[model samples]
Target: MVMFAIIPYLALSAALDPLAPIIAGQLHMSAQTMSLGSGLGNAAYALGTVLAVQLGLHLPQRRMLLAYAALLVVGSVLTAVAQNAAMFIAGHTVQGLATSMLLIAAVPPLAIGYPRERLHTTVMIMNMGIFGAVALGPFIGGLQADADAWRPLFWIVTAVAVLALLLVVLTFEDAPPANPDAPRDLPAIALAAAGSLAAFLGASELTSHSFLDVEVIAPLLGGLALIAGLIVYQYRAAQPLLMVREMLTSAIPVAGVVTALFAAAASVSATALTASVLSETYGPVRVGLLFLPELGGAVIAAGVFGLVIARRSLHYLPLVGMILLAAGILVFRLGMPDSQPLALLGSALTGLALGATVAPALFVAGFSLPSASLPRVFAVVELLRAVAAFMIAPIFAHFAATVTGDLNEGTNIALWIGLGLALAGAALGVTIYALSGARPQTPDLDTFLAGQRPAWYSPPLLSRLRRSHDLDDLDVALPVPESVD
Candidate 1:
């Protein structure tokens, strides 16, 4: 159910790259409209993370999960049978919102509900379901495009959504609200929704307008400012909706967040940008075929995640993933779209990088906090991850198109930046670990599941600078939020 519900939408997100033109032509829509619709969809996805957390705090768990799935089905149907732009955009936006909501509502339980022995399986499923689908999307899109048909793929996604909904019903179990007493935090919700929507909206405008144009820059900067304001507010609020302060103040969680964000931002060159360049030379089918190796890489990473999930080595997974990601970027730079071997190798490595980095970083963050706070912790990390990953693509795309007046030259230049992001992320995470004197220690999943303590020790920021001999005064742990004051 988790895999089915999640894969269709995420796959569709990437699949849209090739399907967009066919969609635009059939719907009698302009390029800008398609861009606008996609922008809104991305916004829903990014904002829905925070919204899911909020709902979890106050709603019936399983009941809401079912609702989210049903909503997803409706959205999928709308897109599948759409006759106009409004229907398609509305459905796409809902699919985005419902997918994230389903993710937050469904995944944490799978992570913490089972025994330690079973968590390895959960990690593998989650990694494959979330990231693997993304890895497979281009091939699926290319097939549909080569067929010169988009409805078939959309129908398939709708069918998957329906299956997911049925799975929800068969597996239903009643559960109470997580914490009814938690603050409403309407302000946080407003800020998150507005910031994500405006930011993506502005970025999407780049398809039709220059970066400096008011349509692109005004809302872009404003949305970013609002997101900054949201973080400050959440960090300072007496009873916040999310665990902003705790994650930011702890060395492990902070490192995890940095690793996740940077890996996501850097991996774009191997996927969307390269696909764009390839599309100019090869037809959709061939382009998708060349990138088919990405799915294999993702599968390997997923298997590796299952093996290391219970071990202390999980902490280093993202670092290794960063190294792989950098190698992949370097390969792409060797001559993406032109060098078939490098493109194949680069796609494989990038698939590995993405699957390895984000999932492990998320778990590392979860392990740094108590198990009960996993949803909130995931919400925060994912929100930032979505922003860094989704928003950076368009900006990079624009840069690649205009910088050298040569598409290939400009794309190679962008690959250089992606390489920097990967390295910088690795360096920052390593630096934080060093500064905090944090070691890669084994996590006690049993203790974490009991909500008794975090799986592993996460020292406060700058612990190396402040600790005494053997850290006598630092014995006490900072309190994590469970309910509103």
Candidate 2:
């Protein structure tokens, strides 16, 4: 199950490497326009996540996997055979939807099938595959683009999808459905989706345009406001979109979110840096060869973290990995020579960091959620990471382009950013470890509910929602309100 999930992530990211150049040269399009293809695809994918929650209600998990895999195959085939750039972009847009569906389908098996003790470790191992593919995909796809044609890479990805489909059918079995009596908060769900979209769109715009620009600020602010409102509404409502009470009151979940941000930024920075350096410095093919060591490292990290590590405190491993990441990036940026062996070692070190951190961070995050909440939790974090990778990477490129007026200089600048992000992540990891060791008593969901009612509950809707749960009911959950005193 783990290996199958890993394959889809690997295959999807492979095309991301060849996409920009292929669109530019083949389509005769400008960089800005080609970038839109990525933005649109990402937005579609984000929206698809909300749809996944509903779809899970109606469909069998294994069947959903098969259907979504078929879509990926179709999308890949379309991309492989595309003659014009429009056709190619369309293919990717569909691919985004298909991949989102695949991601949603995979979550249940991971969440329900695995034991809680192994959950974090399993997730971390899976993430290593994900980041490994992401780190290495660009190099390989870029090489193929240089050596032959970019189109064939799509066919290769399609083959992998077929394999994943077979694996799903063979290994996955559906669990009992959620009780129909459980309250459905459609309004909250819609708000959550809208807020997520606005935030992502806004964040993506932050790099390309001014924060004050109408296109950017309106969406960003609107998104933040909407998400805040969703939390407020969910806090008092009968049921919630994200089970906010459980998330807020638990130190584990809070720690999970922090770890996710740090780990995601650290690992993603490497891929973005590689894209800038390899595409400009060595040509795509040599860059592909350069990443081989990184791929090997990722495989090793996945196995060691996933299969061998038994410690619940394994969250600290990523902190160690962050230190290694900082050292590796510094070494690579400062020590790159003409020698192939030297370059390979630098790449290997970078890969090792990615392998070590990516999975472990994801494991910790997902471990804090119940099975039913896994998709929503994973979607938010994964989507945030994706947005960060796409939007922020270009910022580094743009900074390099603006300041040094040289691609190589720009890559070095990006490396510095990568190093800073890694160090920051390490700091956060240390804080979380210290906090966990302190063993501060967490407030129970029911205790938080028993606090005196605020004036806002005078409103009919809010008041009605609040009445649904008993003030002293031990099991009642409560999300943090938008404004908490």
Candidate 3:
């Protein structure tokens, strides 16, 4: 189930990236136009999460998985045979949507259904499924790109989708919906889809139009407004599509979401920018080689995550990850090196940061909520993350192409901004840890969400200040708002 759900997306992502230049040239499209397809595809991925949750409410899980896999096969076929930009974009968009639907539908069960002793195995699987595939993407794409061919890669993906369909049929099970009678949230779905499409369209426009262009600004602002409206509506809905109120009121979940959002944005933007700059100076193959270290880093992170989970030190893992990410971003800030060795090192560090942080943050959020609430939680987090990570890439890419009319200069500017975001994410992780009074080895998810300080916790700075002011005798417990159980 895991391989069926994850491998195709990773393979497709890997193939598309290195082959992008060749694909663009062959199809008579500009880089920005190509980016539009990727942007929309990712937007579909984000919106599909909502649809998956809604469908899961009304359909048999295994049947739905089969349907999604079948659609993926169709999508891959479209991409493989595409002869024009429009056809390619349409196919890739379908691929993205199906992948996300499969993801939200499949992964939560794997996370929660397994035995407690095997939770680490689940984490390792997730790490490998996601980051591991991403790490391998460049090598596969580079080979195809170096040969100046893309159809073969798409054909390969089509075969994998077919394999996934077979797996779904063979492994079919009869798991009931979480809420068989749950009403479809059409309004929420429409709003989410419209918002994601508009936002991505707006960002894609930046590639050809200035940031202030009406084509760019209106849809972007309108998209954000619609999303804000969705949040307000969800907060007040009788039976919300997502647990907005609960997430808003919980400390750990909020922290986890923020960490995931910023980390994704920073990491993805950096990779896109660096790849564009370096790939131009060096051929696609060398650029792909530069990122091979990411695969190594992801493997290392999976091992580290296994150790952390075994020791019940999940709470501190994000902090460690953010620190590494900050250091990695700083490496890029120094320069986007033409040197292969330097570029390899930078990619490895950043990949390690991504593997260490994003998945662990997700686990933190998952554990913080009850198993029953995970679908909604995962849906909302994936929605926001897709927006932040995928949408931001085109915008950053656009600026990198146009900022000073020098790609290298534009890339440096983007890297500096990415560095700032990484540092800010690290700072936020620290604040969440300190304010929540979470410990390194803590295993109680509820305690963190409830904002209950561990027995050994003391507000180090606050306590010292209080003693200095002779106010240490007064009670100083931080208040935690009541959250949905």
Which candidate wins on TM-score? 1
lDDT per residue, candidate 2, 110-146, as tens digits?
6455544664466556666676776667676766777
Each prediction's RMSD over C-alphas, in Å, is 6.8, 9.6, 6.6
Q: Rate the local accuracy (lDDT) of all candidates.
A: 0.91, 0.60, 0.78
* Deviation from native of the Cα of residue 443 in model 2, angstroms: 21
Best by lDDT: 1
- Model 2: what TM-score? 0.77
Candidate 3's C-alpha runs over 4 A off are: 28-32, 436-441, 444-485
Please, what is the TM-score per model? 0.95, 0.77, 0.89
Counting clashing residue pairs in each candidate, in order, gives 0, 1, 0
Clashing pairs in 1: none
Off by over 4 Å in 2: 1-15, 111-128, 169-176, 183-238, 307-309, 336-343, 369-373, 403-410, 436-485
Cα error, candidate 3, residue 436 (Å) = 4.1
Worst lDDT run of 10 residues, candidate 1, spans 469-478
lDDT of 1 by residue, 403-476 (tens): 98988889988989999999999999999999999899999988998889999999997688677634655454
lDDT of 2: 0.60
